[model samples]
Target: MSSETTAASMSTTTASQNPADPVLAGLKTQEAHPVSKKLRYADIGINLSDPVFRGNYHGKQSHEDDFTHVLRRALEAGCEKLMVTGSDLKQSTYAVQIAKDHPGLCYATVGVHPCSAKQFDSYRGGPSALLSAIGELAKRSKASGHTVAFGEIGLDYDRLFLTPKDQQLKYFEAQLDLAVEIQLPLFLHSRAASEDFERLVSARLPQLPKKGLVHSFTGSVEEMKRIVEMGLDVGVNGCSMKTEENIEVVRQIPLDRLQIETDGPWCEMRPSHASAKFLKDAPPLPKAVKKERFSPGFMVKGRNESATIPHVAYAIAKIKDISVEEVCEATWNNSIKMFGLGEVSK
Candidate 1:
């Protein structure tokens, strides 16, 4: 079915169930603002393969899978293209399959997350074999246009409890080599490991024509400038705008070098965040209900979805004092240029 048809159908279904439902309210708000109709967005990082989308939270299923509904809402909200992050071998494989299943509407990235770096040692054929397998997946998937970048790979010093610093460094470098060899743009992550992250990525920057993105960036202005100096793009999400410093860093980021993502199932925009105040004029989001009371067209509370990506753009525009349309257009082009996702009609 067409996206408009799907959105209309969902809206009708929700309106019939409850006149005061948040989904219907949101749809009405969207019509009034018409931001979704006037703009387009490309969420460069979304954990679509995360089990949360399947209603599995903290290892228990609270409701039926609403992945399809999630996509519909995203499209309806003007987030027309989404990149599914692949943080491990298995998730990478699933991400590629999801891109194939959804075609142009979705794309995939393949890499082992630094936190999961230890998995490299335990793979059936060991670290080298694991690296080779990821290489193969990227090649095959890229050939078919299902995969766009190599990532979810980088350093996370704050989470050393998950994977030791040594392991994260070793595998991150290994994956960097794989990304260089695969010749795809990168989708990266970094947490309190700026020094090492910059050194490693800068060393390999010459070999990567498409460069890459440092996603969920919440670093200091110096760190942001250094990443931009390395010729890498920066991706912002809710986490990137949580604090006053984060807002300032985002405000100073060169618009041409910025991309946006939802980082769904995590990094949601909370009411207490510094960005919340800027969102006063932003688009209204669909109402969220608790998981136990989950309805087909409503968001599950606390679980972020790509549908909320417009809010990210609005916040950025507000922080930077630019028009929301400019933020949306620039990010849409920046993401497509960096990842080569091809043309997406507005």
Candidate 2:
């Protein structure tokens, strides 16, 4: 099918007309909800390597793998480019392979997540070997244009129970040094550890030209301003828009410095979210069924996919009172500028 047709089909809702008199209610529905144009989107942070996409949930195989179908849906929805997030060495390897399988359409990032910091200390080959493996994979994949950034790395005090403060701190700094040596931009994370996250990232910002983004940002407006002032971009996902305060901070984010992500299948937008009100006029998404009842073309319910990225843009547009096209264009450019994902087809 043509791109235009694919875009139009993204919204499955159709106007039902009365055969006797087809002019009033049907026309009103059409007018109130017109078909949206094909606006391009780049999902800058998606965990495509997550086992959930492959039908594994909580260590159990619940259904058949539908990874390719998810990618197809994302492309049809105008999310033409996706950056598969790599939280650690194993997942980073998987992410790189996914990128290789779908060049241009997909990309990858490589680094250890702060929550999984203890993996560094427990690796069979030792901490330095694990770090070296990540570095080698990043360097190789980057040279081939498969890997664009060097993270999913940073501080996360909220999940210190998973990895203590000292370990998280030590490895976060170690990974930052690796990013500096590799000379790649960052894909950072921070949750209630802004002070140290900022201190460490800022200390190295002078040497990193591309800088980086704090993906899935949920900090206060003042915290956001500090990040922007430090020359870093802010990435927004459903988790970033859960409340009124989050929406306000997103509104304050500079369009040029803003990027969008799914961070899925983790940050799915829900009905109770503050951002949901803005989506009243947004295009309807494709039909979804529970994961157990999954089919080839239907989205797995409760499992976030890149195809819903437009909903994110729609919410931001409504919050900022701007056109969705504006949001798409500015964010597409910002992502390309930051990650060098190359030109995207309009």
TM-scores, each model vs. reference = 0.90, 0.89
Q: Give the residue spans of candidate 1 off by over 4 A.
A: 1-33, 344-346
Clashes of each: 0, 0
Give one digit per residue, the lDDT tens place, for model 2 in 150-256: 99999999998999999999999999999999999999999999999999999999999999999999999999999999999999999999999999999999999
lDDT of 1 by residue, 1-346 (tens): 2334223332322322344654433432355237678888899999988878877777787898787788768878887788999999888877886777566678999999999999988899889999999999999998998899999999999999999999999999999988898899889999999999999999999999979999999999999999999999999999999999999999999999999999998999999999999999887898899999999989999999998998999999999999999998899888888887857424
**Alpha carbon lDDT of each predicted model:** 0.86, 0.86
Summing lDDT over every window of 10 consecutive residues in candidate 2, give the lowest-scoring window. Answer: 10-19
- The per-residue C-alpha lDDT of model 2 at residue 275 equals 94
lDDT of 1 at 77: 88
